[model samples]
Target: MKGKNIFQEKETHKYDDIIHLPHHVSTKHPQMALSDRAAQFSPFAALTGHEDSIRETARRTEAFLELDEDKKEQLDEKMHVLQEYFSEKPEIMVTYFVPDEKKAGGAYVTHRGRIRKIDTYLRRLLFEDGTEVHMQYIFEMDGEIFGDTE
Candidate 1:
């Protein structure tokens, strides 16, 4: 009565008789489990695969780099030095680019391992753990074995 509005001024309780009555139980069906009941209000994905497509589109990758003649020569010199010290089993860090399987470009990854072998014929650097890094993919190499060799 203190805050009665025009719409409610003349209105009476339409369900006043049933307003205080307890809620009726459904005898036709048993009570639903809490998990299943909560799932009913959970969000539904109307567009299937839409999120995956967006994620794939938003995924980023790097382009493969091409080293200039001088840089390439320098890398080759470093490789030669590595090959010479291969028998000594030197510990070195090699940075190389890996092409993406699903994209046009990829990324550069660095690996630190002992020198197992430098297969010139196969054009790959083999590690003690049987990891084979392609020579062409190598960006730079550094270790104590390459001391003062530049």
Candidate 2:
């Protein structure tokens, strides 16, 4: 609604323009209805090629990230990791295997970026390049809990 008052004896409400958010895909027109459903996923989309150890690390990260700062501090001695990426809108985010392990031929590294996604049972991250990473696996790794995985 381009801020128009549609109470002029009209049964149908008149719209002007649509304001689109990052997640919103509607290019609303003054006289049109634009609806979009573009679901975003993480840049780090799958665990298909990652080593078991590195994957485990990702899993731990996923789990700890789900916790609030207080709850995270309670469980994680290295609260700094949590603090780095914890916020209403994550100031930092988790990146898996930069430069790509397949090409780099080394352990895929996990680190924090400047943007983060909302945490949930199965959350996904959206990167600057529209890359998406799944955090749910971070909660699924079954191994000895260790210091923030790298």
Candidate 3:
């Protein structure tokens, strides 16, 4: 009585006759499992994959970079020097842009590995580990072998 409000007292009076009654068990249908009953009251996703779509849209990506003439010339010179030292299989670091498979923009990745061979037909820099970087996507190349070329 001390903790109960007047409204609560009136509400309890209305259900006094049935307050101690046993809960009804359906005779027409079998009882549901506790897990299944709990699942009915559990939180659910009405929009399904909408949250994933929103997260994917909110994700950031980098735009592909276009090198200017001066930079392009420098890169071309580096490529020439790399070819000269190709037979030596020099270890090098290459910075390149990788396009996102599901989006317009991409990301710049720097890879360090030993050069395997340059595929002229494919126009890609192949690595000893079977990694390939397309020539057009290359941003920069660096190595001890290109010290004099730079």
Candidate 4:
């Protein structure tokens, strides 16, 4: 798996054939093993996985679909290179792949972000906690940046 989503809350199919007891009989309880797997993966269930992170990137902005699916991949590939400069190198741009109701057309939707202000090449950002809000992650639903001009 390129990226495993073991953090998701989903059904687990873990099972063990047999378990030997000290002096009595052997056990073939499948539920116990299944529950064990569930517990093992539970710690990260609430944490963000790949898809979650992608969506989180969109929730922050409304212009996630400026590129088509094919183009989005191209953009994502380029954005991945571009993301290398931002702190955490987050995939925050592609989050807006889905079309929202406010948009008239489901075509390309680009949020105007001033690339000059971003220092993604350095993998650092001006944001305090390292949230590299990009054009795609802009706050405005109309694809506008909303924050300090600087």
Candidate 5:
């Protein structure tokens, strides 16, 4: 004997006849591929290169250190020792500063190689594999080859 609400009753089917009808076909353009259709809804970047710019800004680099006269003298003496042992193909570790291409600061890198040639004309120390380190940028050099060559 409970009364039913007017809105709660199921609505009569009005368009049930055409509801199952085939979708209308277009005569003008061919159907788009499923992948292409899905791509239309994919996320898009309105600001081009924004992410790259932010990443470049966030990139960090080290500052180059200035060597004092005493340190410079020590480096010079080491270079002299290395030059004497150059013919022996001495294995050494050379630490040098490399300037950043895009930032104010640079970085220090250590290279391990056998000395091939010291090009005073180019002011660079050449390695066996053609790697060259500028004399002005060299911070330190260490090896057993420089031990007894006083």
Candidate 6:
């Protein structure tokens, strides 16, 4: 029994003296709002727009296609053929490259519409619906109107 009492004395924690005391409150500064306190522990992003930058970098774009001399000649011939049928307003499909405003590369877009006019000054094919495809950007032209030309 005496040995047990000695063991209990040795086990007495150092904090036992102040453990029952009241919690200290700051008098200099006012108590923080619950929301403000919670905000301190909330997750914070140090790098703003970092995720957007990464997404822009990862976004894919295609390089513009350059036509060979023979291909360019074929396209010119097709344009002439289109001009010949301009009165009929033939429907055609044209694939062209649209440059990306933000990046170096671009994308190919295929558009189908009736030809309104071939603007020689602008070097573009104008559609009846007001869509225009630049001559230099044109990759391919196809339509049932040019069946014999093929």
Per-candidate TM equals 0.72, 0.23, 0.78, 0.20, 0.81, 0.69
List all candidate RMSDs to the true structure.
3.5, 25.0, 3.6, 22.0, 3.2, 5.2
* TM-score for candidate 2, residues paired by index: 0.23
lDDT per residue (tens digit) for residues 30-94 in model 4 = 34577787888775655559886677556543334344576545544554444444444332222
Clashes of each: 0, 10, 0, 6, 0, 0
**Best-matching candidate per TM-score:** 5
**Model 3 Cα lDDT, one tens digit per residue, 6-49:** 99778869988898999999999999999999999999999999
Give the alpha carbon lDDT tens digit for every residue of 1-150 in model 1.
677786775466666778899988899989899999999999999999999989988899999999999889888888888878777899999999988888789999999999788788989989999878999999988998778877
List where candidate 5 sits over 4 angstroms from the true fold: 1-18, 148-150
Lowest summed lDDT window (length 10), candidate 1: 6-15
Candidate 6 differs from the real structure by a C-alpha RMSD in angstroms, to one decimal, of 5.2
**Stretches > 4 Å off in candidate 6:** 1-45
lDDT of 5 by residue, 16-106 (tens): 7788999987899899999999999999999999999999899999988999998998888888888877788999999999989998988
- Segments in model 1 whose C-alpha atoms lie over 4 Å from true places: 1-30, 129-131
Candidate 1 accuracy as lDDT: 0.88
Error of 3 at 150 (Å): 1.5
What lDDT does candidate 4 reach at residue 94? Answer: 23
Against the hidden true structure, what lDDT does model 5 obtain? 0.88
Which residue pairs in candidate 5 collide?
A: none
* Candidate 1 backbone collisions, by pair: none
| Tens digit per residue, CA lDDT, model 6, 3-110 | 467756667875788889998899999999999999999998899999999999999999997889999988888988898888999999999999999999899999
Q: Order of candidates by TM-score, top first?
A: 5, 3, 1, 6, 2, 4
- In order, the Cα lDDT scores of the candidates are 0.88, 0.40, 0.93, 0.41, 0.88, 0.91
* Backbone clash total, candidate 5: 0
Off by over 4 Å in 3: 1-31
What is residue 22's positional error in candidate 5, in angstroms? 1.6
